[model samples]
Target: MKNLYDLVVIGSGPGGYVSAIRASQLGLRTAIIEKYQELGGTCLNVGCIPSKSLLDSSKYFSLAKNNYSSHGIFFEKLFFDFKKMMDRKNEVVKNINNGVKYLMKKNKIDVYQGIGSFKTKNILFLKDIKSLKEKKEIQFQYCIISTGSKPSCFPHLNFHLENRILSSTEALHLKEIPKKLIIIGGGIIGLELGSIFNRLGSKIIILEPMEKIISNMDDSLSHEMQKILEKSSIQIETSLSVSNIFKENHEQISVFAKYHNGKEVKFIGDYCLLSIGRIPYTKNLELENIKIQKNKKGFIHVNDDLQTSVKNIYAIGDVIGGKMLAHKAEEEGLYVVEHIVGKKPNKLNYDLIPSIIYTYPEVASVGRSENEIKKDKIEYNIGIFPMKILARARTSGCTDGFLKMISHKKTDEILGVHIIGDHASDMIMEASIAMEFRSSSEDIYRICHPHPTLSESFKEAALLNFENRSIHM
Candidate 1:
């Protein structure tokens, strides 16, 4: 007899596990299949969770070592033990991973360990790894594909583990910090990992094919971040094409690349990190039999409701591909499950979704940026307030970067908000909420904000838009 489930979610990533729990809550017999030995997928295992852990540790280390004197706090010969720091991050990740397993068990979601493929629209084939046993089939009334993605490795680049060549995954598990590190691709991963190591006293250089890192973001925003990174002594080389990588000496590797101006430059480093981005990990899914459609980039094609070509099968998160963020995937997973349970659900507002980069003076933004409004030829009024003008910033001694708001010139409705400074990620959420309610700049300005707070910057920016009068600025 074949096992049957009301819902079977393939891939145990954030999207898959969350949806499985929701299905179980809705009184459906649900099962989840994970190819990896670990339960929490890449985000929990290596990507988001672990990276943030390291970033937080590194930030504190940098601050204690360098800025303590200015804050009127003194610690002679301040130091950070790399081994201990990494161990703490690992412990945090392990706790979270175990918590996910507990949720699956508590929710009564069956977990199958191994690769899964679709046999029919409603049937799934599971391959057991340990005994090489094959499960004939399992039937499901509804399916969710949340296979997620993996880091892209260049075939031509010889990634010698012994020589300290690493991908973002391996970089996170480093035993010793490199004296000099050369990173390929200056997108989110490269910039983030680079920043962590850079703060730990590593000389870093980033190579990018585009004219700027974070090319999808607003040009001005990227410029602001570049300046901040430069202050940390990190170098960025844009519009550079890497020709080849070779071992120059017994101790160092030489990377050859051409600059945007067609000049060849050589870089020597103790280690090279590849942060080129990720491709959807759909290789073993055997997508041919089910005839599910995919985009040109090999990401599964889904409708506005996130339903694939097959009506009952849905795809979300990195596999479906928009921002490739864990939070966005969780939202989609919850929405799909609710919709399946006969609840009238609202579609995800992609516009209000915030993007955060956890470098020094973290970057966060939501809604359309000034660049996007201009590109679309929309008329908007812009208001800006520097962190230097905020009393909270002065107290924290992190008075760099600013908050900017974009609103409709005629309607005064908030269009976009961007922030690049301390606690930017946390502060951007309020702006996102305001925009979601279609609040105008005047409405935001009228709100009572406590004096001598970082949050006051939001009110000041809005006031600048309402009238040319911001009290602090």
Candidate 2:
């Protein structure tokens, strides 16, 4: 008799593993399948976790290099070991990977070490590992497809398989920082990774095809980030498209680009980091074999309950698209499991989800941007507060951006909150929670926030929304 499960989640990413654990907690026999030996998918293994690890380390390096003297601390020339930095990142990742493994054990969830795909609504096939030839099948009452995404490869590059040309995964494990690094995209990944290596003394240049970096974000926010990057000595070239990439010398890389008007420019770098973004990694699953469907962008479509077109199968995470945040995937995982267990989970508030960019002074936002509101012709009140006015930011000496709060002018309901400054990622959660409760700006203003803290920015912004009176601002 073949093995069976009440729930089988493929991909072992934030969605897959969390769904398996939740299902097991619900007293359902559950299993999770991962292609790699390690359990956590891209978020844990190569993407979010590793990126954050490097971001933290690089931030420390930046602080030590730039601000330590201002704090009345003087030291000899500081040095950072690139190999040690990578080793530390690997150690953090391994620890988290082990934690996931331990969670599976504690939850008594069976973990299959191979890629899993549906053969039918209730059946799945796992490729045999030892023989590398045989196929094994398992039956499940329900399944979650959490197969994540891979870096979207640019076509014109001829695809450098060399170590020097790296995706996010390869970039995370690099032993040495390239003296000159060319980043191919200006999205979150490109900026975050570029910021890291640049802080570590790499001459970094970000090539973005769009008119600005972080094109999906508010134009003002993108320009703010561009200014910060420029101030940090990172060159950002926008409105440029990559035509091709070729090898110049054995070590030097040639990048060819064309402007909007057919003007061509070339750049030579020691290494090229491609961060064009990622596409759903559903190819290996042979989704067509079972009639699993995907969108035009290759993302699998899922209903509010995260149910796929096939009733017994579901999809989540980067595979399902949106803002590809790990927390979003984890929420979907839990929500889907609850949905499977006969509980009608609350619909995910897509607009309320927050996105964070781990650049120097982190950027985070929830709900709509002012640009979106204006585009929709909505009458809104925009409240802006410079982080420099905040006591916390002045103490930290890291005030580089401001918080912009958008609210319905008539209703005073907080429509959106966007921030780009110290601890913005951490602070945005409060705004997200408020938005989740449909809290108005007046309501947030009524709630007393601790003074001399970063969170006061939220209260001040809220105050500014209704009345033009921000105490500090």
| Candidate whose TM-score is highest | 2
Candidate 1 wrongly placed segments (more than 4 Å) = 129-133, 158-160
Against the true structure, whose lDDT is highest? 1
TM per prediction: 0.96, 0.97
Give me the overall lDDT of model 1. Answer: 0.88
Clashing pairs in 1: none
Q: Point out where model 2 deviates above 4 Å.
A: 129-132, 156-163
Score residue 355 of candidate 2 by CA lDDT: 86
Q: Locate the minimum summed-lDDT window of 10 residues in model 1.
A: 127-136
Per-residue lDDT value at 451 in model 2: 80
lDDT at position 116, candidate 2:
72
